[model samples]
Target chain A: MQFIEDANKQALEIMQTAQPTLVGMGIAKDVVPGMHKKLVMHAGPPITWDKMSGPLRGAVIGGLIYEGLAQTPEEAETLAASGEIEFDPCHHHNAVGPMAGVVTASMPVFIIENKTQGNFAYCTQNEGLGQVLRFGAYGPEVVEHLKWMEKTLYPILKEALEIHGPIDLKNLIAQSVQMGDEVHNRNKATTSLFIREMASSIVKTNSSREDQVKVFDFLNSNDHFALNLSMPAAKATMDPVGKVKHSTVVYTMCGNGTEFGVRVAALGDRWFTAPAEIIDGLYFPGYSMDDANPDIGDSCITETMGIGGFSMATAPAIVQF
Target chain B: MQFIEDANKQALEIMQTAQPTLVGMGIAKDVVPGMHKKLVMHAGPPITWDKMSGPLRGAVIGGLIYEGLAQTPEEAETLAASGEIEFDPCHHHNAVGPMAGVVTASMPVFIIENKTQGNFAYCTQNEGLGQVLRFGAYGPEVVEHLKWMEKTLYPILKEALEIHGPIDLKNLIAQSVQMGDEVHNRNKATTSLFIREMASSIVKTNSSREDQVKVFDFLNSNDHFALNLSMPAAKATMDPVGKVKHSTVVYTMCGNGTEFGVRVAALGDRWFTAPAEIIDGLYFPGYSMDDANPDIGDSCITETMGIGGFSMATAPAIVQF
Candidate 1:
């Protein structure tokens, strides 16, 4: 009982005092420590190429192409078959992602720091929707958008941040929760707030008005722009509370397309696994449950941090969806 | 009954469609459309100099010094005694303020436009706490802060805004309501969100790092910076809903320190007034209820807009107060 009380105290301290901030934007390899060539970060827990689902496999192929190691899906498939590309869980690298959560070396990642604890976490930028790398479709359009985000969006945000400095994201997330964002799945308020805060910086930092316009249009058009930042922000805050010796609290909740996995604090990094469930929700036009993938991605970090599914009552907007 | 339903319909349309945007910032004269020398804008419904409260009188005298029309409080008092400065309600000029809401010609005002209705509203920037003009303190320090806001803070925001472009404030306000801000006295979320949104533009547009630091420090330090903007945003949204024929719905609620006033939609700007109530709440250190002024300013616009005190149940943080 005493141990339980002490663990609760430690968890409370992390939850109450952790200050997560949006420090900057960077590519995975440069920002993520110890990221080596041919290494890929996927969603959920550790899984091999053979155990990978269709979408996960597709994402791995997409990641290979994104990293310029493969030009064609067929070549990428050959490499995956040969076990040349090393696949790893994003959590292993102190990173997380959505869907297949394939993060390659060159992919742009949101850098979130837990200022209170002096630790950091990373997540790849959300690719909006439809035929994107996270969802496993890597068409030419996906490739183009990724390249544009790297070349155009990255530099503008980088320069703007240089002028603006770091943003206290935990404060924002808490406020956003009050404003109608569950901080997972429903992020309309946070995204708009993000746009409002960064719009001017993006404009003044960019020498060209066209770039500013493009950046503004892109950010506003995508409601999920803050999701990437929110994910890592959650991780940065929760990381401190994790790994307690006898804490019964769940630290990490995620999926690798094929299975749902969670890391219990008492069990250290040992993952408790379950079979993945089919996502039961409204789908896009012309798409049905048949086309839907299993619940995948590291997004359950929100739930782990106590706001997503765990606090659905507070965010009825997302619950309705 | 039919007329009442129609008025409600109109009110709903305004509340639903009114898209207020923070278009720009400028001097009261430049932004308020009509201007003449010696005119002053105060909070709430109209009142003569003889009927004004102690704080109202002090703010008026401060305005004189701020405008360089008078050098001392005694001289400003004489000018007021002589009726040389014409005082009018800020609402009459399509503007609003909190407390002793005095707006001189040279005072900097946030310019908000209802993009949907194609109308504008204005409010002076919050002077922050302490010996400030809004609370009726016209000391040299107060005068100095107002001048610095005009000379430094105003221009930096202006340039950053020019680079950033118009902000959809209506969306932000709605989101703020969801986030725990009643959009009246508790605007912490909106203010932080505003800071996050504007920090970068402020950084990039300003040539001096020190100036950028000052602007950031000033804005970040003052949680009420967005309060002024929020009032005008509310007014802009509610204005079109106002003045409907034969409707009992309240359109504007405000106070002039001495009296509380409400404008019904059917009244068409005809204010229904009552003796002001003494503010009963937690006071600053060394101050008691007797030292506090009557409930004042155009802040009750939030209640008229259906948040503020009306929806305190949704914002428990404020309800606790």
Candidate 2:
């Protein structure tokens, strides 16, 4: 079947079926408080060594460690083959993933709820590194770090956010746009801006300066963490408009860590899925696309919300600093 | 007493010092309708005609054409020497120009307002094509296009923005963070996200289909427009915070078409200015950093908001995308 539509037809169809509404929006409500919220963090697809690329393997191994299913890469492999450990696509949870997307449940997830309509969305916290479990890097250090983030960081942030009240993601998004941030690939300004606002509150809530430092370091280390908050924000925005009857608006574009899927706003949450393609991007040293895996993760919510590749033109210096 | 501090110290000191905050960052807002927002755009330093670099010269010629100050390269030279046109630093107007940083009164500027404080800041709009205007090319097509953006594009956008209500920049920043955008060099996601929001309104307001289409084309064509928006947002946020006495918050760091300048929160709007140095970056064909001018423009608002180089970790694809 021909999947591509002519620009004119596409535009007409889009205009007819889709009212240019916001979709798949959510906020990192985890940083804010008591606003009743419901979020959905999808599961990743299952894949074995044969199906995995190098980075994918690495990410998987990292997941095993993060989940505490294995202590080492060797053990991770053995555990996977024995089926002693679970393997599932993030999509199982209605989420998307990037290269080697892998998220264990314990990982903190953002919960976004729409204020206008009572809809919501969810996504895991950012892993804070290029090569991560969500990215398919199974290693001891990776596991330990994930454990720490979940055990220490996520809870702290969740609690702090609760006390902080509802963080208005719309505000952050607007501010980010003005700060030279595209919100998908360049979130430094957003994250920093967020931290600036919440740092004092977070510090006031935490008894442990060490934890505060850790949180700050982690936040400072990962410029995309605020994105964790914003995804839910986008998710919240998208959910209200997602229920339009017979609408062509995209509701969700999730990756189950195996295939990429979409749910039309008019079609409810049922997804139209396509096998995920490997993302072509620069790799870390000693790695290449050959080492990349099928795109996985809930991050594509950015695109559903009208960001990501759709806006690449805004950032021509993308390939370089 | 010398008010100027060291670069790094000034960064900290501006935020630390007590001073009045500047408002309305970005040129688009400050520009009077029908009056091209004019700021003198300058470069790192002066260069001899014989030493003129390709991209730098090309940018100047583009600037000339954009300003309609010259009919041709030969004519542009005459105009430049005739003293019929003004050559001043963008900083003088409380604005910035990036790259070659050449600003003519005819060039469009972003106007940003601090909602709470009512401070204003301005910066010229992005030229779209690489190695143009800011890179120091003076020519006719450039001038005509600038005129078009001023006469046609800017007014429509201003009205649409007004109708849309004030864009909540903070909200975009937060959402963009989750989308993997850092609000700096990689603003693709942020850029597209904003366009998606504003497109419908812009279409509704445009009188003729052709006019609407032209504006759409311009918005879609210019990737850097979102960057313009982001810069102003950062300026707005940082401006208020910088007003805090001895807060040590860096409010502004920008190049005035010819020089790099910084304004500490403590220092208020006092510019600690210096000659802009050439940047080290990948350039287009037949151009290198050697062919480039000193980095100019209020684009540094990204840095002020903590993206650009600050959050390089988020986009590991830097220098590799």
Candidate 3:
């Protein structure tokens, strides 16, 4: 049998939903474009001093202060240098953070389990961006947004999902594709469809409009917002098959809140390092490429599977980066 | 060596969007339960004498009158007997009619293509049920509604689809499944999503609220309103495979608007007739199996490839017919 068939694949074991792998204790890192507050979580790969980028370095310093590991950016630099604080990429530990990839402990992550496969992964919600942790921008606003996502959006989504049971990603992908989504670059149909499906449940379960709006805004915020959903889905998909022994399918491409790397299933989690590719996407009328940072998380596999860029033909209007 | 694995056997060819099938015009025969005055077009599965329900028979007479084949119902009956007028089932010809699948040569239809599969089928716009032809209800109201759909709904959809291009059935199926649709039954998500996608295009192309509202009302009226879309998509998928020799996949199933029949690739185009099985679906509450027509039309095969009944698991709320 082929290691994996593009037409379809079976989830061998259903991963049950569980507690967030890095909830309730992560240090806030800062922010980045299309993402918010960064926090330092464990990593699947390690990095030496030379590989860090300005955005990633900025995130590390910011995460230290958020976690109270250091009182100032200077102090945080010392802390990381002293190696007293732990530094790990989000992917190694079954999690992925958005740009800047800073996932701190105590940050309540939405832990996703592939139901047909016992593999699991975690991700934080997307924050409406510009000067956020994932964008390598750190300050009061980033932390506050992170606080809101953790305190508000996560709870509402988690509760609604529990009541609704598993949100079948495969099923959603199929329906979304038919409705005009290729499932990677364009998710307007998928996102709107998902919100309408669960909106009733959210309204019924959450008494406050403010609370309900919090979740809604998060989902409706960014266009790449569905990227979060697609990432964990790919991670969960790769995790199970990674153990198949010599299977060439890719498992994880991640960051240590510092540098980028890729992991292959056949290589037994052996990492292949490469500088993250520069993002090519539409910018604000005044903003251009110099403002864009290199790729920062493990969401790349979404492209490998005939989606994202592969399915760009389905979305002719996707803004060119 | 599996029939399904061979691209020439089971793979559906892509469809082009410009030319829609089921193009001929037709007069309505009333088959509605609680309404009247609706006209429609149908595709595929030819129907013949002795197979029609009484309401349908009455509709045919009315159609002859509408077409001016006879001056009255009594005269129309003579026309049918003399074979002076046509009485072909819509499905027998790559088309479908609303309800009793009524059609006459004059109504306009939406031409959607399976661009990726190069196969096509057609259906008329929905006539709102209160006075529509599909329910076996016939009269001026049915005729007026048919006019409205043709004049209003069809144009807006045509323009919107033109701007957006072909609607991909595979993607739609995936999204629908995730959105909690078995596609056939629970399509709340799919229907809503499609509306939102087309809303912008409608706004841009259709300046008349009257026309816009007509399509809107029909879509919001029934959950299965998107069923027409699914039919053409299934048709396109089946066409390529149907032409593949030695392929065992069944290509067509129809009731000729009266008797149920199936056509398989390996078995050739010769239709094997079967007594139409009773259909199982929600009928405007209070209506029981006594109210349902036997499973008719080429529409049911949409379920065979994992939609409709095959996807019952996705929509648990569907009632047993």
Candidate 4:
């Protein structure tokens, strides 16, 4: 008991003192350890192709098309079932993603480093709401947008970050929290703050004005843009706790569409999993409980770090939504 | 008395309904009526060169050098004293500027239009704090910076405004008031909000990335950048009240470094003046009351519109400064 208490205290200290800085960005294959061309990472615990849910399957198919591995949904499905493509959890590769979080090798990711622990975490950019790859819409428009993000958004932000140096995530988050952002469901303030902070450097990059404008417009319109950064920041913060031997603190909590899973500090890579439950929350127009997918995404990492739903009172505006 | 009360009601209604929109920008000589190559507009009521305060005189010299009419301070002083040059108040040409408020022929000025009144008001861009033209430091660096603003900053913002259409100042000010900005001495929130609003369009301009970045960097670093806009908006808002018959409202208040002046509605263009009072507020480091300049600039236009210091309670954070 004494050993467990001490380990928990150590884990708590690590979490409390973690300094997550958004260091830079890179293509997944180039930066994420063990990422490969044929490898695909999804949110939550690992699942075989046959067990994957609709949204997850849709995202994977979209990712394949976006990656140029397959031209059509039918072809993507066949290749996925052929076992030639390897599927793994984003968590296994020091990454986290949101709903149907399918990340392929070519996707751009934010590289967040936790200075206190000298560890890093990664996450892909958020493709704002409605008919997006995250929600499993693999349309041509979605693929084109993703291409634009890779071609235009990625390099501009990368260069801007170079100019801006590493931005302290802890400080940004603290400021946003005070400004009425839960940093998960309500990131409007966080996104605005980020835009304000990056506008100067972003304009300085070599990107053409047309491209720069596109980036600014995209970020301005997407209130959820900072969610990706916040997720990786949480992931980086919690990763050190995983190494605290004898600590029983829950370090990761995420759900694939088919199942919910969590990992404890002392459990050492073992996941405690159960059947995922359907969300009993508000739905968009023309949708109801019957159309709802089961609980999903590594977004719960925000709640795991005591924000998001854990601190809903900080963002009263989210209640209306 | 009844006629005056009715006129006052009309003036109040006009002020309440005034919609000042930032329409565009142009050179003062080209857009401001009565502006000429040899005419220099200063703040407050008109004064001869001999009576001008030290800061006002310094700004006049800097304006001459900036306009290329003189090569040195001595040449500038000779030109000012030679009767060949003209000195007038910015208020005479529907303009307002801060501090010494010197407007030269080629200086860029924001064109703020009161849509309801179909009249326009103009103000030069704020040069930010210390050792600048507004505070009357006319070093080579100041002249060079002023040139950069005319050549680089003006076109980018002008094109961006063309793309952005008209920005409604009333709505922007309302939003900023809620965010702890007095829109005068504290324009941090207003500037940030303006940057967030304009960034998308600014990036879309035809300017080179280097130039665009310079513009963004300039705006981002200058927390008082929006002060210029607010002053012109206030001027535009109060200008309509000046046309009301028999109204006793005090609509215009400004100061040259040498004297403070006020204009009353229904009294036409008559200016009542007194020797300017020295500011008894906080001083910057290495300065004291003994070194203080008299109360100066067109900044008090914000106070005239019932914000600025008039509504200081709305911006409690300004007290710390």
Candidate 5:
């Protein structure tokens, strides 16, 4: 009991003091070390194409299409099955993604620094709901949006940041929580705060007013702008605390569509894994629970940080929704 | 008693729902209606040159110098004595200022709109701390900083804002209060949040990187950047509530160096004035409490809005400071 109490103290201290800052945005191959051609980072623990869940496999096909590695989904599927591409979990590269969480070398990623611990984490830009690459429904629109983000939004944001400097995500998160956001499933407040913070810098960049409006309009229209940011921030915040020995506290939690996995502080990098439970929520139109994949993505990072599902009590309104 | 209760309820409702948004920044002549070339605005109720305090007189001199109406403090004093420079309280012009709170033509000012009420308010940029225009010391250095703010900082912020859009100060104030700021004498958190929100946009503007750094460095070093904004926000918040008739609740309070004044809701803009009491706080080195100026500035707006001194119980740590 004493050991558990001491461990809980250290875990709580890390949760309390974690300071995540949004430092920059850049290409995966350029910013993320060890990222190279033919290397793909996906959500959850390592899994092969044979064992990959349907949504995960769909996301990989979409990634291939986005990277222009294949002319069609069938070709991409064939190449993926041939095992010619190297696949690793996003966690291994200090990166995270939602749903299928497929990350290719060319994708843009947010750079989050754990200022308190001097470590870093990364997450791809949120594709924004319905038919996004993360959820495995990669179509022409997904590819176009991803390309647009890469070509226009990413560089403008980079220049704007060069002018402004890093943003302290911990401070933003605290403000968001107070404004009624758990920051995982419901990021309305954080997203608005992010837009408010970035709007000024985005306007000052070399981008045209039309382009700036496009960015702002997209951000204003979507309430998930901070979802990717929160994931990386949570991961960075929990990293150092996870290293405390003899601590029984949970440090990391995730799902890969096929398995639910958690990293316990005492066990170091070892993952405790189990079959992912069937998702039991209402689905979109033309979709049913039968079509649902098991729990997936790196979003559990929010839960690990004591937000998301863990903070449901503070957000009865969202629970009602 | 019932009338007072109704007025208090109205004030509370306004305080709870006031939405002050920073819509623009511009020259006073262009932004503030009826702000002509020769008119000057000061803090608190109207007072003649003979009745003004030393610091107030000194600040008026500084304003004259900054406006190029006079070349020297002696020349500025002569102009005031001649009664050629018309002096009106800032409150009359939908503006507020701290201490001497002097404003002259050509100085840049923030344009804040109360979106809920469709009314507006104005305030000049902060001159920072020590030996500044608002505090009554208008040295060459004071004039220099004021000119720089007008020429450089103001335009960049203006352009940046044009690109981004208006910022809601009511939202910012709510967040600041939660983060340990009464936003009157202690605006540490509000200042940091403002810099964070503006840094990126300030960077994107036409200003050179070096100039941007100068602006950022100045803002980073000073914690009073939000003081000017807070004053205008408070005024805007209380404006609607102050319109309630036959109510005895105080709507606004301020002091020039020579007279303290209150405006009751039932009395409209008519000021009830008394001799301004000398401040009794500990003095700086080489100065006794006797050297302290009478309670001055339009900062009483914060207290009127139920913050600052009125919210002291919410912040014990600041009381210790």
Candidate 6:
């Protein structure tokens, strides 16, 4: 019991002191450990193509097309069923993703580093709300947007980050918390603060005026733009905690559309999983529980460190939404 | 009393419905009515060169150097003593300014339009905190910074405004209130929101990356940047309210470094004046009440509109500062 208590204290201390800084960005295949052209990383526990939920399958189809491995949904489905493409949890690759959380070879990802522990974590840029690839909608528009992000947004942000050096996410998250942001569902203040911090560096980049304006407009329009950063910040922070031996602390919590899973600090690589639940909360017009995907995404990692829903009182405005 | 009540109701209605929009920017002599090359504007009620406070005199000297009217502070002082500059209150020309509140020919000013009333108000860009022209410190660095604003900040903002059209200050203020900004001393939220709104247009402007980054860095560094805009917005909003016949609402309240003044709606342009009182509040390090300047600036226009100190509850964070 004493050993467990000491281990738990070590885990807590690691979580508290971890300084996650946004260092840079790169393509998933190049940056993420164990990532390769044929492997696709997703949210939560592993699943075969046959057992994947509708949203998960849709995202896989979209990812395949985005990667140029398949031409259409039918083609993507056949390729997925051919056993050539490897499916793995984002956790295995020191990464996390929101919603369907699919990461293909060519998609750009934010690289967050825990300066204290010398560890890195990765997450893709958020595509914003509604009809996005994350939410299982994969039309031509979605693929085009992804390509634009790869070609336009990626280079601009990468250049800006070089000018800015490393941005301290811990300080940003702390400031957002004081400004009534839980750093989860209500990220208006967080996004605005990020825009303020990045605006200077972004302007200094060699990108064209049109491309620069497009980046600013894209960031300004998406209140959830920082969600991707916060996820990896959380990932980078929590990953070190799992290295504490005999710790009973729970670090990783996420759901694929089909299964919910959590990893305990002491358990190393093993996972405890259950059936994913349907979310029962407010929905957009013409949508209800029946239209909902099973609870999904690596976003619950925010709560593992005791923010998000655990500290919802900090963001009273979220209730109105 | 009943007639006064009805007139006050009219004034309040006009104030409530006023939509102040930031339309553009221009040199004082070109845009502001009655602004001439020899004429200069100070805050609050009318005053002569001899009666101006130290800070006011400092700003005037800086303005002279910036306008190329005088080469040094000694020459500026001699010119002022010789009565070459015609000094008047900013209110006389439908304008407002903070701190020392000095405006001179060739100084760039923001054009705020009351879309509801079709009237305009103007104010110069904020020079940021400490040893700047607004506080009346006219060092060479101050002069150079002012020149940079004139040559660099002005042109980019002018071009950006053309592309952005009119930005709605009322809506922005309403949102900032919810985000904990009184839009006076605590304009952190207001300034952040403004940056987010303008970043797109700023990036789209033809200015070089160096100039664009300078603009963003200046704005990002100044938390009180929107104070300049808010004062003009309040001025534009209240100017229309004064046009209501028989209205008894106390609309205009401001202070020159030497005197405090107020104007009621029914009283037309007449001002009731008293000797200015020194401000009694927190001060920066190495300064105290002993070093306090007499109450100054047209910033009370915000308080007249029931914001600033009047709506302090909305911004609890101000108390910390």
For each candidate in turn, the TM-score is: 0.83, 0.44, 0.50, 0.83, 0.76, 0.94
What are the runs in model 4 whose C-alpha is more than 4 Å off?
A1-16, A44-54, A75-88, A171-182, A185-210, A242-295, A303-321, B1-13, B44-52, B78-87, B171-181, B189-209, B245-250, B258-283, B286-290, B306-321
Residues A173-239, candidate 2: write the lDDT tens digits: 6655554556676676567656654543454454455575567667767767766666556555555
Among incorrect, acceptable, medium and high, the docking class of model 3 is incorrect
Please write out the lDDT profile of model 4 over residues B1-321, one tens digit for every residue: 899999999999999999999999998988999999999999888889999999999999999999999999999999999988899999889999888999999999999999999999999987866579988889999999999999999988998999999999888887666555788887866777788889988888887777877887788778789999999999999998988879999999999988899999999899999999999888878998899989889989999998999766756355222
Which regions in candidate 6 have their CA more than 4 angstroms from the true location?
A1-5, A314-321, B245-248, B314-321
Error of 4 at A87 (Å): 4.8
**Span of ten consecutive residues with least summed lDDT in model 1 chain B:** B312-321
> How does candidate 6 fare on TM-score?
0.94
TM-score of candidate 1 against the unseen true structure: 0.83
Docking outcome class, model 4: acceptable
Clashes of 1: 11
- Residues B127-165, candidate 3: write the lDDT tens digits: 544655655555666655666665666667777666555
What pairs collide in candidate 6? none
> DockQ of each model against the real complex?
0.18, 0.02, 0.05, 0.36, 0.07, 0.63
Per-residue lDDT tens digits of candidate 6, residues A105-215? 899999999999999999999887667888887788899999999999999899889988899999988877766678778777778888988998887787777888899
Model 5 lDDT on a 0 to 1 scale: 0.82
Docking class of 2: incorrect
Q: How many backbone clashes does candidate 2 have?
A: 163
Q: How accurate is candidate 3 locally (lDDT)?
A: 0.56
Q: lDDT of each structure? A: 0.81, 0.56, 0.56, 0.88, 0.82, 0.89
Candidate 3, residue B307: how far the Cα is off, in Å: 23
Task: For model 2, state the Cα shift of residue A269 in Å.
Answer: 23
Model 5 per-residue lDDT tens digits across residues B1-321: 887887777767766877899999999999887788788899999999999999899999999999999999999999989979899999888899988889888989999999988889999988787779888888999999999999888988898888668999988887667555688876755666576566556655777755665676667566677889999999887777768787776878999989999998888989999999987765667987677888889998999877988765544234111
Pairwise TM-score winner, candidates 3 and 5:
5
- Residue-wise lDDT of candidate 2 within B110-164, one digit each (tens)? 6766555555555566667642455455555566667777777766676666655
Expressed as tens digits, the lDDT of each residue in A118-186 for candidate 3 is 556667666655677766666666666777777777677767666556676666655555544665556
Best candidate (score: TM-score): 6
